[model samples]
Target: MDPADSHTDEIALSAEEFDAVRAALARVTSTGGGAQAHSLLAQWSALVDEVEEGYSWCAPELDNDLSCRNALAKVWPLLPSRVRAIRQPELDCIDVRYRRATIPWPDRPEEGARWWTWRVPRRLDVEAAERRDPDWPLGWEMMPFPRPASVEVVTWQYVPIRPSTKRM
Candidate 1:
């Protein structure tokens, strides 16, 4: 079902609960998150999804915006602390640099044959050559387009796509 179309019950929470969740997100974002920290972050993110299911904290009367969900969406993928997003024209997408990694950074040689490269949704696969940081957002993982096994797929599928009730 389209998330925008589903009408869920209001998420009930007190100020304290809100504060706790916010603090947890902040803590997870600011420190070297251990396994326990990652676990807490997962739960906290889920709470954000639940709380904003049918309501937005940014504007209470606003049915047009899902502010709470949007905030979590922005933060969840690119945890503010562990990764630095650098947009690279080479990859045609943002190359995420992890903290405490090598200094020379991504060792990929800038000079490469253009025909040998490809972009799968975002960054070129070559840019993600190193070991992935455990904390990197799931969405950051770029996969090969047109799987060798199934060469028939054509268009990309999207989620929560805007409905065409009013017509484009």
Candidate 2:
């Protein structure tokens, strides 16, 4: 992960992955596992804390979508086999479902809207998507899924973008 990405807002973990990390920590701590296990457990515990504080509780921007993926790539290989085997499919499932929800319409982008609206369908059930992956910085609709397609539509509103005050 980039050192600059350490901003609290840039960390994310899916609900299932967070739960798996907690469960693995509990098992390892209770078993009094050795040095390597303790090290891994500690790292995972910190990650859990970061995710809970950074993404779960805080309201993060939806436009940038790689925070969770970048964070996970660094830590995933270190996770225990059982946790890895169990969580991969669950995460993949969510990715698949969310991807389906985001297919675009075949027509050109709507007037006064960014390209995101083209990828994410109109009138998406935001609440249901949030329920599916509450850990996402924004709802699942904000995720940058691969290969958008043409899908149906619903109600949509176009809001004007404002300039940011913060200096880069």
Candidate 3:
């Protein structure tokens, strides 16, 4: 048998395997899992870069590449609970309560203590109600127009996504 032909017999990963590797790497990378996880991710990234750039693979390099990917897959599941708990922030609509009242700060009555606070959604339609046209006098007024005495500006909150029920 030709020595060079042996290379062809080495296992090449299928597309599904590649996808699994990528998904695990992406999750660990996004969380900044830890020094060890970062190191393993870096190794996997380097392997991907080389593969993409058409680097010639020696037997040892191919073995190392496969090993690195497998190690990363294993490490991802074993990350510290706190690190695993980390997640990307998501946009969430919140309820804001504000009232027309004297400003608490001096010389800023117009900008006054209008003292506004936000709370989790009392219901999903809060955003729609806050954004709709004024109902007080039954007409829409453009900006710089007086807002009702007590009005809430529907806004968003940046919060870490929950593990379950991913959507708001």
Query: Against the true structure, candidate 1 has what lDDT?
Result: 0.29
- Residue-level lDDT tens digits of model 3 in 77-132: 65443333231010000001111111122223433221111111111112332345
lDDT of 2 at 48: 33
Candidate No. with top lDDT: 2
Worst 10 residues of 1 by lDDT: 93-102
Q: lDDT by residue for model 2 over 61-137, one digit each (tens)?
A: 32244333433444456565655554555444433433444444456553332433344432232322234332322
Candidate 1 residue runs with Cα over 4 Å from true position: 1-10, 29-146, 155-168
Top candidate by TM-score: 2
Compared with the true structure, all predictions reach lDDT values of 0.29, 0.39, 0.35
Candidate 3 runs further than 4 Å off: 1-35, 85-168
Candidate 1 local lDDT, residue 52: 28
- Residue-pair clash count for candidate 1: 0
Q: Can you rank all candidates by lDDT, best first?
A: 2, 3, 1
Worst 10 contiguous positions by lDDT, candidate 3 = 87-96
Clashing pairs in 1: none
Residue 168, model 3: lDDT of: 80
The backbone clash count of each candidate, in order, is 0, 0, 2
